[model samples]
Target chain A: MAAFALGWLALWELAARAGWISRLFFPPPTTILLTLGRMLVTGNLAPALALTLYRLALGVAIGAGSGALLGWLMGSSRSVRLALDPIVTALHPLPKLAIFPIFLVLLGIGEASKVALVALTAFFPMVINTLAGVQQIDTTHWEAAANYGARGRALLQRIILPGSLPLVLVGLRLAVNGALMVTIAVEMLSAREGLGALIWLAWQTLRTEELYAVLLVIGVLGLASNSLLELTSQRLLPWKGET
Target chain B: MQITYRIAKYLKVVLAVLLLAACTPIGEPATPTPAPVLVRVGVLPFMSNAILKIADAEGFFVEQGLTVELVPFRSSNDFVPLLLQGELDVAAPALTAGFFNAIARGGNVKIALPLTAFTPQDCPVVVVLARKSDVEAGKYASPAQWKGATIGISLAGAQGLPGYVVDLFLRQAGLTAQDVTLTALDPAVQGEALRSQQVDLLYAAEPWITRLLAGDDVVVLSRAEDVAPDLTSSFMVYGPSLLAEPEVGRRFATAYLNAVRQYHEGKTPRNVELVAEYAGLETELVQQVCWSDIPLDGAVNVDSIMLYQEWLHDLGLLDRLLSADEFLATGFVEVPE
Candidate 1:
């Protein structure tokens, strides 16, 4: 896969060098890499990356924590499910960006608004996935837990949580990815820092090479995060076998 | 199966109708009429772009043998890319670091005409507003008081006209950019930000200036005109499509300047009506907001543009400092001696 990626980049570089593509719009990979290196050396990339990651971490934690708790409740109690399902169904399809202005108004145009937007974007996938995770657990497992005298917290800790672990991981992965995306988007709209702001600045200043470099950084960050999540899931769920 | 069958039957009927419509032909005229050259002009619903609307409404484009298509855009970011890509024949956006940067990077777009400027007679097209509460509390009373205060602008990087104006305001008081934090806020929410005390000062343009001034929330700190008199704010840019055909560009300019003459005729009833109709503002609001000056002969201030380029370059927002000749496509319209 690495070789294939290198070959693809080589073709792109060749095309740009050969003038098949407009260099002003699509700089060669080498140019992008060099630009990225310059940004890093010049101490521009690190802070932006760090801020974006920080926002993503905080947003995903808040969103996923609340979403999992509510999802578990919804799955455990039919009354909860019926009440929230309509609200969730109505809201899940609405774009998070549509409500960003409201967040800015409520939270003010600061870090709070950006973080809130990211959290909202991360919330839906986590809730939906976690709800499915809890519902899909076998009823026999619950009965078995009860037979073993497991109740309330004990039942939750030993049976429900462990049984629902796999889908919960899936939910977490989705939330993290969504959180990152929203972080970049909100930052682009109204921020002076982060990869999104860098991208916006590059765009505003017509620094196409710099824009491409920031985009590459974002892509790598996404890939690295997903890999880390996958490795973590494997370690947490060894019994699931090769997942 | 029944649903699929019904869908297929409906599709067949639709296709039959389409085929019938396609086969039907209208006879051509005996004399072949020359097609008017189509120019796709991108515009934002701002007072600055009143000339494009005036030109269209007054049939100036028709007189020039051009078919003008006014494409509305939300922001320069939206239309700049399109203009670069040749999707838009012309665009009139504020003179920004981005536009200069594009030209430096070999984007086949050139400043065709001066769109708007700050003149003595006109109200300030852009202004710096301080929070009313802050002003009442004896804060931001003068430029010296702006030290360590947060100023909200529509764009960051200090690369645009507002940034230059702010810098001018700062320098007059021996203050610099480091003394105050310049935060970028959307123009739509700038009033709210100031009202909520998110930022101590706002660099705003009309009709936002008019609307914000309506309430007692913000007090005018400085007018851009007072700071930088005769400063050019925006320009009409010609993309590759228009640039490739000099005659078409010249014709467009001719019509545009004709409209500029009408615009300079002041707020006539017809002019106000056209501006209101084009800008999607009420006639009263149209009359209320301050308008920028467009040169009667459409002559650009070359020195002013060069000064802006130097400022951006000095600020490190622009990598290449462009010469006036490199970006300005002159001789499209007559410049006064």
Candidate 2:
């Protein structure tokens, strides 16, 4: 895969150098490599990479936590799910970004709004996943727990929750991806820093090569984060078969 | 379950650290470089990209011994920090130089050359609509008071420039941003927003404005250039490194001037092709972005810069307003005789 990607890069550079693709449509890879090299050497990537990861982490943490709690409650209780599911459906489909002006008015165009957007997007997948995990708990396990005097917090925590772990992890992974994307989108939309902001900055200035470099940076970060999350889930749920 | 909860708790701590990092301010503030050889150029899509593409594709850059790179941006907000980081060579934003220069003291790249100058047709397009009852009022009521208005701007700069200028125009008669609530929409969504009565005013660049005006129904409120005559629709500026490179800057300028001459003389074809490709639109749409009636050479406009300086001061966008001479290099304003 790396070789293929590198080959693509070489082809692009050669095409640009050889005057095949419009250099305007695509600048040479050398320019991108040089720009990326300078940025890496100068340590500009640290703060941006750090900031993007931070937002992704915060959003996923808060969003996933609250989502799991809510989903568990709703899934364990039939009545609550019946009532709240409609509300969730109605709200989730509404464009998350339509509220930018409202946020600008209330939150004032700062980190609060960007963070809020990430959290909002994150909450959806996490909640859906958690609900699936909780709801799918085997009925036989509930009966078995009941036989042993398991009920309330103990039954819910030990039997029901453990059974739902795999489903919940699936949801969490989705939320993690959403969290990163929302952070970039919001930061790209407004905010003073981050990788998304870097991508946006490159476009406005017409640094074609640098633009691609920003994207490459984002791609690597995204791939690393997802793979890390996947590995952790696999390690923890050793018995779980792949869906 | 207990293990999961513990894992979640630990994850929260890790995530918190990352969130704060994204928000943390670091690196050198935007400022002029000690010296530079590389002519770092940042470009917006379409017109600016096309111009740069022409310079690159047609041996213009090679002729001038210039090395150029094109950067992609989703919008103007992304450009802000990039400009601040001194990562770009030049930035030709939809906004003026002062707004960018103000966000940080040193990291901000100042405007260099005005690669794009415009007249009525070359700038962003804004149309004001009303109930037939209101237009018949004929008293020119505040656009601010025109509640339930839908305005299309690509980003804040798109909304900010026209809305700010027009708001002032409306305020002269009695109004504020509070008076009329403006919903922001991108150009692709503008037509639906307008047709649905989701918006009363639509502000975007031409072909949209041109198509809207071509329609028999919608009323043209005012042209962008007429509203802000001294305002530049878009212009170019080198980042610190690019500005500091005398030879490259000089060569870049010369090539840019020649390209402008070719464009004006109708000697270029690929310029349009590049503009279309960069804009993620069709070739005809790119062709529609004709060089404004004003000059296209990379000559910095004094009055436009001064107007931007005033806007920045008024918007409290600057710590101290820098003079045109101070903000720009000789390469920017001087068209090399």
Candidate 3:
């Protein structure tokens, strides 16, 4: 990973230096770094960066938590699964961005709409993964827990949950990335602040350098958040990392 | 066990804090060290040799201590917001709609030079081209029959520019926009649409018109000049900021006008190559597109601005009706001593 990043940086700088490519069209990696440093010196990153991560966390958490619970219920109840599967399948193909206008119109283009859009983008993967996880979670595990006097909530916590957690984590990673994508997308559509808006406003004014600067900031923030989430999943399921 | 809960609790708290913090104020980028006094100049493919080649080559802008740049756009909308925001210094922008949108949006851009002076009998720059079939069917067989039908003007930003009203000679042939679908095809895609019969009428300016005329299948339905005997289609404009920096504004205008003069006189093969480079066209194609749309002598016509104000108002684009004076941007060329 380090080598890939370093090699890309070297190539970018060399191209700009050699005059093989116009720096105006694609600025040097160092120029981006210099701009990023200036942004940091000015303390421009923290607020928007924090907001993006926060939205990702909230969206993924809600999507994962709800999807897991609902998936388990559907797995246990055949009737419930039958009713929801068609509905889920029916709505799955709609373009998430195309529906943003509906959200904006209904939700009035606030944080509520942005959060909802992020959640909407995230919820699908979590639900689908959790469903698969729950179906494949052994039936014997629940029976064994009940036989040991673990009932209801105790059965869920002692047996069903741990069995399904690995799949839920897969669902969670997907949701986390989805949440990040939707968060930026919502902001781009219409927001007074955030990295997407920053890129967009710069584009409107033909500030290509400033636009690239904002894009670089968003990329770093996204990578950092995803790395943090990966580290979290490793701690939550230590054996998975070893495997 | 306590540490695990504590970590989760702190994580939740941090997450919530981050989300809540998003509600606060953001600092805008402080004015960076002034860039190389970059002036964003909009250039069309037609002016590639006349305007763009000079700016790109010949070091003309360096003399003015300005870095003249071209924002080659297929439509005026791309330039409109930047021009309004004081991002662009000069735009050899296309005339849109009945109203001057750039000046209306609080941008201080004015006519830097008059391109294509108006004459009563001269062919206007903006015109409606229809299939000879549509024109002869009492459909505008020629520029004379363009009224009362919806004509296709390529690009969304152009639709609002009143190309329909201006070139059709304000004849109001009873054709509402609904009568003809003003399909929003980009000019590059126009040939396909024309071949497909998707658009019955097309509003094209010179060069595109001249190029289409080159083909035997497409006939000159109308010269934009035939429709309106006034309001020449081409113009150069600079907003207040650039104009206020008289030294900067004059240099760009002078270099640009010099380039225009160069093309009118004729370009060297090298100069032709430079224009073609930016135009993304071959020399033969560039020659076809460059025969006209000349950088003629005249200033921004008051009549054109008035036409825009009046027509855009009728189109319900403006809240308060503005007169020609309200739209005219000043500080262009000084009057004779």
Best prediction by lDDT = 1
Q: Each candidate's chain B TM-score?
A: 0.86, 0.71, 0.70
TM-score of 1: 0.91
Model 1 lDDT per residue over A113-212, tens place: 8888888878888899889999999989988987899888897888778888899889989998888888988888888889999988888887889999
lDDT of 2 at B188: 57
Q: TM-score for model 2?
A: 0.56
Per-residue error (Å), model 2, residue B35: 19
TM-score of each: 0.91, 0.56, 0.49
Compared with the real two-chain complex, what DockQ does model 2 have? 0.03
lDDT of 2 by residue, A93-158 (tens): 767777755655555334666677788888888778888888778888888988999878997789
lDDT of 2: 0.65
Estimate, for each residue in B79-151, the C-alpha lDDT of model 2 and write its tens digit.
5445555677676665643344443334435665665554555444443443333355652364444444444
The whole-model C-alpha lDDT of candidate 3 against the native structure comes to 0.62
Clashes of each: 0, 34, 17
Over 4 Å off, model 1: A1-3, B1-34
Residues B194-281, model 3: lDDT tens digits: 6446566676765576667676556556555544555545567676577678767766766666566666565577666776676666
lDDT of residue A194 for candidate 3: 73
Candidates sorted by TM-score, best first? 1, 2, 3
- lDDT, each prediction: 0.86, 0.65, 0.62
